[model samples]
Target chain A: MKNGRDPVIVGLADSALEGGRFVKQASVLGHCALVANEALKEAGLSMKDVDGLLTAGMWGVPGPGQLNTVTLGEYLGIMPMFVDGTNIGGSAFEAHVAHAAMALREGYCEVALIVYGSDQKSLRSRTLGGRPSVLNMQHETPYGMLTPVGGYAMAARRHMHEYGTKSEHLAEIAVAARKWAQLNPAATRQDDMSIDDVMDSMMISDPLHLLDCCLVTDGAGAIVMTTAERAKDLKTTPVSVKGYGESHSHWAISEMPDLAHLLPAAKAAKRAMEMAGVKHSDIDVTQIYDSFTITVLLSLEALGFCKPGEGGAFVSDGRIAPGGEFALNTSGGGLSALHPGMFGMFLLIEATRQLRGDCGARQVKGAETALVHGTGGTLSSGATVILQKGLQA
Target chain B: MSYDNPLPVIDQDSAPYWEAARQGRLDIPLCADCGKHHFYPRTVCPHCFSDKLSFDTVSGRGTVHSFTISRRPAGPGFADEVPYVVALIDLQEGPRMMSRIETDDVESVQIGSSVEVIFVRATDEVTFPYFKLT
Candidate 1:
């Protein structure tokens, strides 16, 4: 059995939403505080007990958002000794959890709180352009490639050229995500969808239809962590953070090590699983980030769930859909569920919920081990975390 | 004097490359140590991390590694150029770079298509090294 010093997630909460619509309007920071309070309440703790604060988002750039941890700490009245504002696109939260785990285990912080909130949907500020045409972005932005969709489209097209992966293979992923969304009440898009429907959606970028992309919604999620000994008195069942790892290869799509495969994800997943002493067969559920259908396909291959170039075949014939052998993105994922700008925080939240048996219709039966992975910044960054129920070895 | 498309911001590290482009030349950074070429001009060689680098004008020939057709305009600035082709070009000197494959018939462009660099003068100081099917 693991000792008491092992770091475990004691609380997890997200802002209540009905079909990705917040009941009440709030600023990005407002959403952050709302979710943080609820998560702390669930853990039977309060703002006074939070000694570490971590957050990341695409808000207030050119302003206070630059110092996100400091801005969030001031807003929440948290004088956290340990703060992390590391933002590597959407996968920032998964990396934050890895950082928090080390901070908790090393006695740098007693209680760690990681939060993420975004108002992109509410503010209607989401843009198709890439990051500001400055620095390294100057090379990509001048050419007018659609910010994210175009990059994924290039990858999807290349995957087809190399592995003979067809558009239908990618559409199956979107269709399956929508099928899972139909079971999730909070999912933004619950309507039934077919492969034909996905293929028919407007082509934002060639090879990537409208449905291939994730939804734009406003959301915030929080996770609270402490040592296993402190969890003995908490109200919620502590989910052990067995292992975690993160890596980024290149910011520019052209500089990616390989277009057909995700090298960083392969490295990150291998390290995390090895540290957890688990194998592919030991994983019961997963919450893979679905920024785009191709994202999921590439991620599955990188995670070693299937051989390279076999992700298309692996996800076909209702394999990852509802009642499929693999329960992937049980919260409907960023595809059908709420995307909220950054989707990694929700990946962590959903995996924790699945491990606690909190998911009702979409729950994996007797799920004990859940693997959550997040892909960020045009397939540039990858972070993986392996979680298990209680203190089981 | 009416070009409205976005232009690349030339910096200290990338100034020489842009200067060569203004002269209608495709100059890319070549590492003197490893004898390798790279794109988007960096101070150090990405392959061998060598500081001994010089800008060299090459044949400006490449193959289309991958591409995407932006059915919708990327932004308001690109509103007039709807349904354009953006592609990653595998340069003959061995380094991949992102560029637009300018063509009247978008359907004709495909992976492995042979392309050669063509310069488009956007402004007094900036010239985009666009690619066209050979």
Candidate 2:
């Protein structure tokens, strides 16, 4: 490690997942404790040894889910010195990692545990509707824009209009994700799918087919972070957190500054890569949040992998597929793996696993550097983190 | 057909915007300092920190920046209106707003097409400013 103060992820684990469903059915907090204990165990530490806690979920707001860290800490019986219960949407965990890095670097906490759990599929709590028609949502819900999906669809349509992108380009992303998922035993949708399959799939929103969306499943993930010196003595090889940045532009999709251009992602990625002192070419693998196919495309462009309006071409010709030049969403991504509700936590887990060479068939060969970006709240929030194998002196 | 759609929940800051819609007018908050317009009404100027803001009527004209056809209804309230067109309108006044684009053929709605706001009284308390192709 370069410095004793450098923050590195020492442990990562997800709850018992079978066909993308939580095998050990438990409450949100129960799953939280389950994944937390597993991840801590991987780090050769227990919850009692943790001094910091970070968590987020869509369990039950205005109720138990309120003050998530307090509820989780109480459930896990750990009173921490640092706590963050930021609920920015699916990408909250990525933001948490960014915050945890700062805390670990500053010695605010000795051991930081970030956890997320959701039972949206098991409970069938996932809704195809928009948010409540109140406050900022009032302007959107009344018009019946199928939240999340509709926002992404509108962006896809605009992207096509501006850059001559095709639905086929978007389909290639879904097809590619499925190919990766087929190799992942934990992936929920491992069935073979082609571009035509995505095109023929039912349309949830125009310009976005059912296959273009991510899977809805029940899952939970947790990660443990500490200073490089402490992580060096942990159970597993630590993946150093080289750089990270988080930002949000809007809550309502209508408020997005630019549909064609993901400004927040560009800003976050620029800062993270700049801090890591790496260029786009130096990134060996990328695990971007795929809330929608368009999200991956837009994120690739914003992350500097390709030029804006060039994402359509960047992802074409199966370049991002298994045998392709670029390795993206190797854990199958949210598109084909599992999207319980918030998927940012899983991105971190998979990115860490890849860097540790824990993945079997789906591993990117000699992957030393990985870029993980998460898009939450209908492209309203973007968080980018840069990770690398082996600590730098 | 009977009106069975979700209605906007008006709040204090957005009361005037809805009131203007009820009067068949498209009113939005205009920042006196930045001279910029914002939508879905807010207390502070989004572009500038100045609280010097006032309501002004826009041309009710915009171009469709982007749109999507919801093959599935957004919620139970919109169950009867599947395949609806929700669009982001780039208002002539330079601000963007989200509203449904009503047309006989939903597929005909294209980006860059001109649209004008048309107020639809959902109830005594709610008047939605939907758009129609011009």
Candidate 3:
């Protein structure tokens, strides 16, 4: 916390997933309000206290001319000082946190709320059937390579070819995650599974098993941020934003120059460490996105937590399991956890909980420092944030 | 077999890929100045950003860099084609292309297996490029 710029996350909340009420329970506008209200309640603040609102681009919904800040402010009867709608795939939430922090540091906003809620799992058939307008669908969707799984499959295929990575190794990641899910009450897939189970599961795309992909969930999450000076008086213990980094390698997987190396994550991780003045070993827990098991493996290598091409081996050896050298995705990750619209917020929530010692069975002991990484758009973009306790500015 | 539907559409950016498919050739964009080859058929050279590029028809010959036997069909259009192989073939000329394994069974598509390009006409405007075990 230096430079009078430390921003602290003071409040967080997520919606429940009961009654199969994914998308229909609340209109898209209502869903945003529902989660936003929960977050405000947790922070002991009224909507009038908010000065900024940030939201991810709605995945399957119509665009709101006014970004989330404007729309939410319009509903809450308060004008926001700043509004941001920077969309970067699942990592949108992480990117929003970084953007809000910068905005606060620049004295643009005294308080900011970053939120994401989606009804992807509950969308009508029409919304799910057509090509997304925001995507470069014209170029990549044809030839039956239209889905996210297809893009990640190509990446996994190349990784296997170049490094001799085994399918069993990928299965190891799914099996381990499922095992962790058994202890997570909120996990969607809590049944016992083994490597063979993953290998035997139906394949969605080549090299991408059904278990390898993330769950389609309907939920929303919000994070409240304020300057460190203001966060001291807040009800909750503030989780300080120690360091952050972000980079976009390409707009599409086909545009990525090297599948063997996830350069963006590497560069972003380096900058994050530099900004935090901490090393990789100092991190007690990590919540890297798991859109696919390969994502986690690749991120481990890119983040310098493990060597290149050793991701497969590193994960298979139980290095990321609970009580291992480093704990990863203790909330079961998107693979087994509920994946709201923007999965990145779930990573942030898990990281914050771990640093605050909120996770019950999956908590890493004495977890003082946490790393959260999010991958967006077919590994085309990535963002990393470091969080620590007692560092509030 | 069930009733057939119209083939998937191929846009301008990917049109050349389909054109090369019909000729039973695997063509990649090669930078004339840099002598570098790239995939996904971009008009400009990724390395030098030179628009001076040409479609170089290479020997469909390549080693299976990595491959996966998809047990489930990717889409309704491919439901009958379950347990198929999709592979990333590393061309000897330097480029990786995603194509299906043109084999009777999945077991035939193995890592490092030698493959040759083949074409299956999908419609008037779309033709899929596939690889067969050599």
- The reply for model 1, stretches above 4 Å from the true place, is none
lDDT of 3 by residue, A269-326 (tens): 8888898888988998898889888888888889998888888888876666655666
Leading candidate by DockQ: 2
User: Which lDDT tens digits does candidate 1 get at residues A1-393?
Assistant: 567768899999888777566767787899899999999999999999999999999889979999989999999987999999988889999899999999988889989999999878777888898677667877888999998999999999999999999889999999999889888888889888999999999999999999999999889999999988898899998899998999999988999889999998998999999989999999999989999999999999999999888999999999999999989998888999899989999999999999999988988999999999999999999999999999655
Write model 2 residue lDDT over A308-381, tens digit each, in one string. 89998999999999999999999889999899989999999999999999899999999999999998898998
Model 1: residue A238 alpha-carbon error in angstroms: 1.2
Evaluate all candidate structures by whole-model CA lDDT and list the values in order.
Answer: 0.91, 0.90, 0.75
Proportion of native contacts kept per candidate: 0.84, 0.97, 0.24
Clashing pairs in 2: none
Candidate 2 whole-model C-alpha lDDT, 0 to 1: 0.90
Candidate 3 wrongly placed segments (more than 4 Å): A19-24, A60-79, A124-140, A157-164, B1-28, B54-60
Could you tell which candidate, 1 or 2, scores higher by lDDT? 1
Model 1: clashing residue pairs?
Answer: none
| TM values, all candidates | 0.99, 0.98, 0.87
**DockQ agreement of candidate 3 with the native complex:** 0.27
Clash totals, every prediction: 0, 0, 1
What DockQ do the predictions score, one after another? 0.84, 0.88, 0.27
Question: After aligning candidate 2 to the native by TM-score, how far in Å is the CA of A22 from where it should be?
Answer: 1.4
Candidate 1's displacement at residue B106, Å, is: 0.6
Weakest 10 consecutive residues of candidate 1 chain A by summed lDDT:
A16-25
Model 2 chain B lDDT-worst window of ten: B1-10
- Which scores greater on DockQ, model 1 or model 3? 1
